[model samples]
Target: MEPLFRLEGVVVAEADGRRRIDGLSATIESGERLAVLGPSGAGKSTLLFLLNRLLDPTAGSIFFRGRPLQAYDPRELRRSVVLVPQRATAVSGTVADNVCLGRRIHRLPCPREAVAEMLAAFGLDTGLIDRDARALSGGELARVALARAVLLAPEVLLLDEATASLDPPSAEGVLRALFAGLSARGEGERTVVWVTHDWALARRLASRMWWLERGRLSRPPEGADEAGAEGETRGTAAGEGGARR
Candidate 1:
């Protein structure tokens, strides 16, 4: 499969010589659900930010579909590869309004069937559509964000600690919905790059793992029980997180 994204010796640093990402190189293929793992402040977010073009590398280059990232129009690049941040912001509007924000931004007509299907796919009631977004629970907010993002059908979805703010059951629900959505999308139809600290999450959702520590990326050590990876790319074993997520 062709690489959806390729990073070559990329470096992202602060003005004071603090490097958030250092000499990183990797290839993310189409349809690959990559779980980025690491301790706190390990540059996972920074890497995702770069992938989403929120920040450019200080050196080296990043390529999308073999073309330089900067070569693509920023608005166009972002549409195909979108980032859903950790803290989702719900505009002061109805759930339908929030969910359809993408189509609005793109100036497309509102497809009501599409909206309802997405809401159901994410385990949300269609009745919630008329409800206020800010009044939704944490779990509801997370699902709303996923519903919003997936509706766009991005080729690559960059999730930066997306479900981190939810409770265990809510997080699991979100993961399961995500996996189901990917499966329904068919292989190579969509790619997901999720930054998570949960080993169980990685074990369930990722066929390949990219562990980041100290601003560098590498595969996890051999014999580590990244369970269920060989069977399915769907996250299951929902356990409470122990380490800092």
Candidate 2:
């Protein structure tokens, strides 16, 4: 399959000479759900930021559909490859207003109808439409953020700790909605790269899994349980901050 998103030798470094991502390379095909597993500081969030073009790599390049990302307008890139951050700060408006913000910025036509459909698809009630965006609970805010991102009809979705703040049930609910929405889209129309520390959730959702440590990315080690035993073990080491993610 052709890759929807590709990173080649990407690296991100700070002014203090600390490298957050080091020579990382990966490819994600359309419709693929990839789980990025690593200990805290494994550069997982940085990777998402890079995908969203929120961070420019100090070295190497990123390509979207065989075109260098640098060639695309940042606003256009983000509209096509939406990132739902771990903790989103809701804009001061009704939930519906915030969700429709994307189409407004893009000047996309018929935003109201599209926003309503998205809320329904995400299992959110219409009542939330009138609710204040900033007043929602953490989980509620997450749902709104996700709904807003989906409104963009992104080709690639970058999720950095998407469900981290949600309780288990709520998180599961959100995942179900996400998968269902993806299925409803045209074949090969979307790709998801979700970064999370939760091994169990990864096993349940990911079509493939990758592990990161010390700013490097690798496939799951040979003989490691494909169903998350490795993720749990890695979690312990991850607690020590070796990954500096």
Candidate 3:
């Protein structure tokens, strides 16, 4: 099968002359679950940024569905490729409103039956649908964000530490919902590229894995030293990338 995404020597450098993603080359096949693994400062999130066009590369090229990344209209490309960031951003509306927001914005059909089924699949009670979104807890808000994203049924879903903020059970629930949502189209019908520090979770869900360090890919399946270590594996608040609490 043809690859869904192809990167050839992709380079992303910041304004200060630092390379966030350096000379990365790889292929992401359609319907594959790829786990992007690395320590903090490894530019894992930058790769996602490049994929979604949130940050354009300083050099090299990225092709999506056999076309240059820059070839597609931003709005149209985004409609087919969705990214769910680590932080869940819920709009100030009821749960039902939040789930239907994407379809409404896209001018698509809003099927109530499908909406209710998705809510139940994510372990969300039907009663929550009429409740205020802003009043939800961290886990509840996470599910709400996921429901909105998955309902769009994007061809590719990019998750940047999406489950890192949730409690174990909640995180597990989110994972089940996500994969269930994907498999809802039949197994391996949609592609997923997830950036996560959870090695065990990666092992469980990702069919393949990539290890990045200092903006470059390393040999995988043995990327980091510890599997369950509590560490930050993405950009830091100070803009300088480092790993720790």
Predicted candidate 2 versus true structure: per-residue lDDT over 1-245, tens digit per residue: 55777899988999998889999887777766778888788888998889878989999999888888888999989988888888966878888888877767899763566677878876678767888888888777777788877766778888888778787767867876876665565445567888887767766667666788767875455644454344323322311122112
In the range 1-245, model 1's lDDT, one tens digit per residue, is 55889999999989999988999988887766778887788899999899879999999999999899999988888888888888887998999999988767877666877778889988889989889999998778888898888777678889988998886666767877776675565345577789887777576556567778678875445444445233123344322331111
Which residue pairs clash in candidate 2? 41-243, 41-244, 41-245, 42-245, 43-245
Cα lDDT of model 3 by residue, 131-198, tens digit: 89888877777787778879888888898888777876677667767877865743346878888887
Per-prediction CA RMSD (Å) = 5.6, 6.8, 7.8
Q: Would you list the rank order by TM-score, best first?
A: 3, 1, 2
Question: In lDDT terms, how accurate is model 3?
Answer: 0.77
Structural similarity to truth (TM-score) of each candidate: 0.85, 0.84, 0.86
The per-residue C-alpha lDDT of model 3 at residue 7 equals: 95
Better of 2 and 3 by TM-score: 3
The candidate 3 region of ten consecutive residues with least summed lDDT is 236-245
Deviation (Å) of 138 in candidate 2: 0.9
